[model samples]
Target: MNSSSDSDFFDVIVCGSGPAGLSASLAAVQSGARTLLLERLPGLGTKLLASGGGRCNFSNLLPEPEFMAAFGRNGRFMTDALRTGGLVFIRSFLRSEGIETVAEDGFHCFPSTGRAASIRDAFLHAAQKRGLTVKTSARADEIRIREGAVEGVRTAIGAFSCRKFILATGGTAMPALGGTSKGLLLAEAVGHRITPPLPAMAPIPVDDPWVSELAGVSLPDARLSFTAGRLRGSCRGELLFTHEGLSGPAALSLSGPAGRAWTEHRDSFRLILEPEAETDRKIWCERIDDARKKEPDKLFRSVPGRTMPRSLAARLAALAGLEDRRNRELKNADRDRAASLFAGIPLTVSRLSPMEKAMAMSGGVVLTEVNPKTMESRLVKGLFFAGEVLDLTGPCGGYNIQFAIASGRLAGENHTGTLPLEKQG
Candidate 1:
């Protein structure tokens, strides 16, 4: 490894060439800055290729308020960025690069070709045409700062100087795709505080024995709520019973809150699972009574399946102490108990799945330390942050990628000095 002098210096250096760094580098070069993109991996977008099971859920088309709300408290910080056409800008940028997108369920967006490689290749082609220098397999060792301002970065390849720098190394999730604590370490070195990172979009473990019995059973439109005293977190989507616990969209989205609750007090965490439309326990009881009248010989275990999976129905019947009886043998009290179980089946949450299995993580460089408008560090001039490296985590359904692209776009577009926008076809 050899150090580079002034001749090789760049106007801006973007670290990590995932979605965020790619967007940042493109924005910087398009702004007429001599930009350099540094990636530790041999290839870019490694984790990205696995998103949406390879279909690549690039972004969502949700309206601004609804989309931002998915991020919880930090969502407010993205107001100016999203309002400035962040999501739209990314989509438009892709379209300009000849990559088309299709919307799923009128909200989730994916590449028209259903390939993550298309987006990755588009970025590489654009960077090359704009003369952006990308160094793959070059790990950034340290961020150099001079008297509270950006100086340059020390990488495994060599030390290089830059007028500005952006850290988009991402959070410590999906370790197989290069996720690590390197970003957190770099931020700490630069006088930034990082919140304790936890698994966000990840599966959750439960203490119930039925979890294993019902493994592979999936419930669509199930509502899961976790409560720790007064603090509560909830999400409604598909839920899956796993050998160890619960999974699928709803459980994964709710893991962040549940993980925090468990940390507050392990035994305080409790999860309630029910059909999304479950509201009145009495109504369920009445439905059961009607079923008993319609067919007195019907099996009690088969009753709950009308609202949930047959396996779940059996479990609920057993929980309510009515599984051994037929509908005709059930007394009014037994009917009520069975109905109540269906309304809200309580499950003890053991903990969240390990971070390695999570899609994204909660916690990173604290949001307050960066200027949300430009993603530039408020404490360190000429230094910026973006993507999962920041203290922002969103629910499943393309929100994370949207934030990465938006934050990176803002950082690169607003980089200081005179510049010219690269002409596009």
Candidate 2:
């Protein structure tokens, strides 16, 4: 915080310079508030510059309903925000700023330049053009609350008063990528409940020795089913086996709840990996049976299917004690065991990968305490929240970023403590 700013106070102050913070600052400025954006890092969007392997999956093409559902039970909290600044708005906004986006796979959107720096630079250039005062390396140490409302913020350098403040400090995932808990701490000091921040959108490490051997193996599509707290379900998408465990859309989508359930419950849960939507024990059994009559001399492992990775098939076959046997040599029990292994391989996750490896976190300021319509705290007037700092975690794609932009915009635009009158459509 610069004590030498022409004024030490502003109408709106947004903390953290990630996607949410940048968006909040822009929206506040546009809403006619004298706004200031603060960043703890040396510059803006350090984490965002590293998102999507630097490609920056900014948003997606999912419609409102399906987009909201991707976030599970608490997704509805973002209804207003999403409506205010969903994909259409985001894409148009980027285009207005000379940044074109493309949904390369017809879903996950990326900047046409394929560089996250382009997106970050767009925000930087726009902020400069709009005269939104942004101070870097200014970590908010304390959020000063007057009575029951927000008053100002104090950093090690200086204290800047504000009529309202927004917390977009993001989550504790990828600490190296500008992730920290300062925003959560500040919220806690001012009477906000914070969920235990857990790693999400990252790989889950397992102790299965055979899984480790299939490090480079990729499944066409994989399904990971688990029960974690209120998020009990399955995630289906592409999957890749790693030296430690599973990584890819499927594993990453389920990692959040699975990790939380494993640590919180103090019990190891089964991580079921089904290779495809139609795959089941019966299908595997039939495949094996057909192979016995058509190619009886072939190895049992080769009977899994043409899509199954050779190494993974062999490993699963070995687990069923059928690796070295011919398809014709499989007895009923052997065939059943092989079918089960092929259908859904149960892998034991020793532990979820650390926060340093995660794309985002599962926990944050619980959604209940904040008003979804305005992104404002129900407990504290003039205090608002956006982005990963809230208890909203999406799968490994463009969902989280889209929420950040939308929620940040809502929080910033509504900093005056009221919703904007929706124009008659």
Candidate 3:
């Protein structure tokens, strides 16, 4: 990267040094545009460093549709980026940079070195080698516009002029990583409408004694369903019981629906731990009967223990009022009660963890106002946006980072028309 004392003006100015800003600046510089990247933090990619619990699931190899579905309805906006060689380009770019990638679980990709710093270093080195200037500890407070056109940016350091500007400032997710409303604020200043951001992909706080009681217990896969009047949704993944409530991939995925059910319909959420195909309440009864005929002294808790943790099994038996009851002594009514509880347990959701605890925020810069193909703002000339600043969010497993990198490259490549656009039929 260029030194902090480098020149103030450039052909393109990228604000924020996360994945998007880094990709944007690198693209601009490679296209022979004089580019400058400004980062508010002393270091770069703080949030990226913290992604995937610090291991950093940088990208994924999921087919486009499955990848897009993770972001829900707003996912359609990614069509141009994904189809116009964005994902392929990123994979190729990383390989060319000598940064090896490894795919886990047949989809999620991470640095072979298992360090987020590797990705950050690769980007910073490439940008600097391509003659990109850099400024750390510099904040872009405002976009300087005049006569209904582009100009420069007002930053903590000073005003830097640019023919074109790209805003990759990100949303309010993790304050420790420097996520804030700066980019949203700048977009609004240019007359762009911003959808209010809400926390997405975070843990849900449930008001149940058992949730805390079962803290630290985890289920590899569980089905989570929520119902409140007209709203209903379900997600399946690993579930982790926390001191406060639920976490892990399944809980994070279900948080959105749970939030909606509580906010819109005022309903409680439910979880089906290790859900079974047999739901007639006879399956569990028969299993208990068979075990009783063999052992003749098996406890009721042993049935649930086969599929769940021993502590959770004991807790469920207690909740069903058969904690001390033996399998042989369990009446038909007792078996039915335990069967229902195991099928789907009810849990009261008080609220979701605050935005500061979320992995990503769900809303920003209305998608329609920006060109998906070019990552440029339709409302403002010579303006572009990318990353979490957009109105899109994806589930766990590297989808979010993939979008950020792809969108960043699009914004970088198209910000100044240096990289030619594809011919449309």
Candidate 4:
């Protein structure tokens, strides 16, 4: 990377150094454009270093549209960006950086070394090799605009002018990683509309204190459905019981919508746990009856352990008021109650965890304020945006990072008036 002492004006200035910002800087430099990457922290990719449990699920190997579905409501917003710079482009970019990747579960793509720092180092190395200036410990205080166009940026060090500016500052997730709402604030100052940010992929707090008792307990191969009044959606994945509440793939996917619905309707919601097949409920009942007949002294909790986790079985039995009842002595009322409890476990959501603890943040600069084709700001010339700063967020498992890289590459390539692949080294 270019030394901090260099005072030369750059053709492009990229703020933030996460995946989006780093990708943009690298793309700009590869296009033979003099580039400057500004990072507030002393180091780069702080959030990327923490992603995927520090392994960095870089992208998904599935088809583009199918992968876009994971974004829920705002999936379409990324179509143009992805079309210009998709998984193929990302894999090739990593390959050029000497970071080989392998796909797992037909979705997640990770470095061959299975390390997050490898991916970060690849981008940092590529940017440095291309003569991109990286300024660490340099925070962008404000965007300097002139005549409705980009002029330069005011940093902690001093004012630096540039021909083109790209704001790749990430959203407000993991504030400890240097995420601030400043990106939105900066966009708003330039006449861009800002969506109200909300926490996505976060754990939901359950009202039951018993949930904390089952901390560290995990339920694999289970489906969780969330319902608030009438709106309902189901997500099937592994569920993890945490000391705070429910988390894991299933819980995190539903957390955003559940949190929003719970806010509008504060009463309660239903989280149906369809562990067994719906059609097999009758057969399950028959099996339970046969077991009861054979083991008269056995408790109801003991029987459910065969099908469910021990902690979950005990919790369900307790909820049905059959904790102390012997299997053979269970009445029709008790049997029906147990079935109801098993089918649909009621988890009263108290609140969503803080944004700092979320996997991703929903909401950012409104789509209407940016040109979808080029990812350039409609209000400011020579200025672009990509990544979490945009009003789009996807589910866990590499979707967010995929879009960040795609959009970053698109913005960077377009900034220099060239296609992504054509500009690549």
Candidate 5:
């Protein structure tokens, strides 16, 4: 932070103050480039401040291959970005800035102080020391271009000229955090094709009222699966029933893929929730039989009730039409129905969490339009993009933030390093 008023020009300008923009500014300044960072919000990193319930799970420590896989098919787009500022670099960068990080669960990394401010402050401190100018409450509305190259950016305050610019404004997942389409619109106006964004990492708002009835109940280890059109994904973890629909890790992680599929086949979209995910149908049948033998007169609800929350078990039993029957009274058809229900309960998905309620989103700038190698626009010189603006999305557990920081650093470093061939010519 150059806390003083803005200058008319700089070597680089970063639009957005989220993790990616912060990293870009810091990297540019660290490389001796006169840099300016503009943020639309009054404060920086609003979404970041709310991340991980404010603990800010910032990175993951998995090996590169597995790490990339977490981001799905387009995960490989982050190869160069991650290589430039991966887990090791981030940990070292934080440590050098007097902030230490720890993977509290031996996976997701967070600041030792357990505050998002720690990471944001570290970047601010480091970047300011290197002369990075700051402007908040300033939104970049247009990118001035000349001969297919970025010249400067126009903001509400004023126009700032820059040889290089980085766009890391993120997606429209949370409007309260100032998430908007301005960034995407800015890129689109400059020739980059944007993939329509979809709300993700949020609960699925099902139309089924029975799930709402089981609100406050959770299956600690359940598998959520969805298959519709081009969408196919599954995750096993906690599945929580909410007043509106489903929440918890399993649902959140599956929400992205599920949303994509559901949006396409809204009327036919169906999900399967496996309460006994680890136990196959055969095993479930055996358990039900054991319950039948040991408690012949027990209500059939006690079958699944033994392994899961009684309320949910009772609901599933009711769904399977055995709630009022006893164990000994179950016909073979009832047995098969109960076992199948326990194995994989069919759930019709009516809608996904809206953008305003989402924690993250899937889809962004089409990956093909930008070079992950340098985070530069393939169609426009001196214009770089990073973070959630890209098409790649990962599961929960800090994957999103990790990519943001890494991609930002890579974009910053390369954007300010060498002049483009067109410029040189």
Candidate 6:
């Protein structure tokens, strides 16, 4: 509700200054468009600075097919944008900004400097160098739509007009970094269909107090399976015990489906941690047999050290009622019990962590409402969306950033071509 008399217009206006917004602004400016980048926070890329434990994992080097697979079912929607603006382009862009990248395990890429701030500064520098006008502490109050086309955005300061608007306002994650549902609300007011937002890439809440007692214990090479009543799926990697529940790669990957399942079937939702190698019960049985003969003095719980964390091993053993007994003291039934415990350590998942604790959100503008090729809104002319705001969230790692930058670039480059706003009437 601010005055607009002194507001300046631009060829392109981008809301939010996260990875997607900055990337879009950069692309727009590079394309010879007068661009304005608006952010609600006092500084830009607040969330980016906190990613990858303070070292921004920019993108992954995997092929498009492999990269897309990480996104699950919504992966295909990103094929077009990624094909045009994929990891290759992102790597090249970062290099151009003098922020070199190095590929780590699983083809995950991070800044050579190992500092997320470096990547953030690089984006800000690029945007400034390209003459993109950036306005911080400028939250968009509304998207001014006239005749079914975007006229401009109304901010706290005033109304700023633009030929095209890019809503890269991000999803409702990391609220401390300025994420809110306002972006979805703005889109909805303009006739865009929004997918109900839910927490994704978040930690699962376990009610067991023993989990908190084991906080800081991390298990690598473990597989986590999430089961909601009859539905079940599994992810294999690492898990870290937190005071509230479980976190880390495997736990985060299963959070989305687990959260959804928990909502529908609150009575029963479980997280099963199995030794990565013993995913096959036969293999576990053989290992149990070997342990019984070779290391009879070793506790049954100690057997999991070959597969899970020492802490997890002890917990599993205790769960199977074999923590006190030595491996040699185990009867044949005890061996079966130990194997069962090692194969799947079930933790009752109570619920999802709050949105503020979520790494990313699952829902946003439905994909069908936007053109996958250009990221332009089919319902609202001259308006486009990218990043977590688009109901296209992928698993944790570098996939989310890749999707954000790819979609941003695509929307920026295709903005003008998709802006036949006069027909919106």
| Highest lDDT scorer | 5
Tens-digit per-residue lDDT, 208-259, candidate 1: 8987799999988889987887788889989988898889999888888778
lDDT (C-alpha) at residue 118 in model 1: 87
* lDDT per residue (tens digit) for residues 396-422 in model 3: 788877888778877877444554322
Instruction: Give all candidate RMSDs, comma-separated.
Output: 3.5, 3.9, 4.1, 3.7, 2.3, 3.2
Candidate 6 lDDT over 255-361, as tens digits, reads 87677777877787767777563456667678878888999898777676676677867877787788888878888887777677667767776557899889899
Which lDDT tens digits does candidate 2 get at residues 1-425?
34346347777889988889888888887776777888888878998888888999988888888888988878898999998878888888889998889987898999999999888778767766776888888888998888888888897557888868899999999988888988899889888899998899989898889888889889877788875444466889888989888898888888887877877764545678787757788988888888989998998888764667777777777888876999889888888888887777777766679999888999999889999989989998889999999998888788998899999989889544433322111
lDDT of every predicted structure (CA atoms): 0.82, 0.83, 0.78, 0.80, 0.86, 0.81
**In candidate 2, residue 235 scores what lDDT?**
87
Best by TM-score: 5
Better of 3 and 4 by lDDT: 4
Instruction: Choose 2 or 3, whichever is better by lDDT.
Output: 2
- Per-residue lDDT of candidate 5, residues 1-425 (tens digit): 33554446777889999999999998888777788899988898889888988989988889999999978788899999899889989999999978888886788899998899889889988998888889998999999899999998999888878889999999989898877888899999998888788988989887788999988998888899988866678999988999998899899988887888787877667798897679778998888788778999999988887888889888888999888999989887888878887888888776678899888879888999898889999999889998988888887889999999999999988454453212211
Report the Cα lDDT for residue 10, model 4. Answer: 74
Candidates 3 and 5 compared by TM-score, better number: 5
Residue 377, candidate 4: how far off, in angstroms?
2.0
Clashing pairs in 4: none
TM-score against native, each model: 0.94, 0.94, 0.89, 0.89, 0.96, 0.90
The clash count of every prediction, one per candidate, is 0, 0, 0, 0, 1, 0
Error of 5 at 124 (Å): 0.8
Off by over 4 Å in 3: 1-8, 84-86, 267-296, 415-425
Candidate 4 differs from the real structure by a C-alpha RMSD in angstroms, to one decimal, of: 3.7
Model 3 worst lDDT window (10 residues): 416-425
lDDT of 2: 0.83
Error of 1 at 394 (Å): 0.9
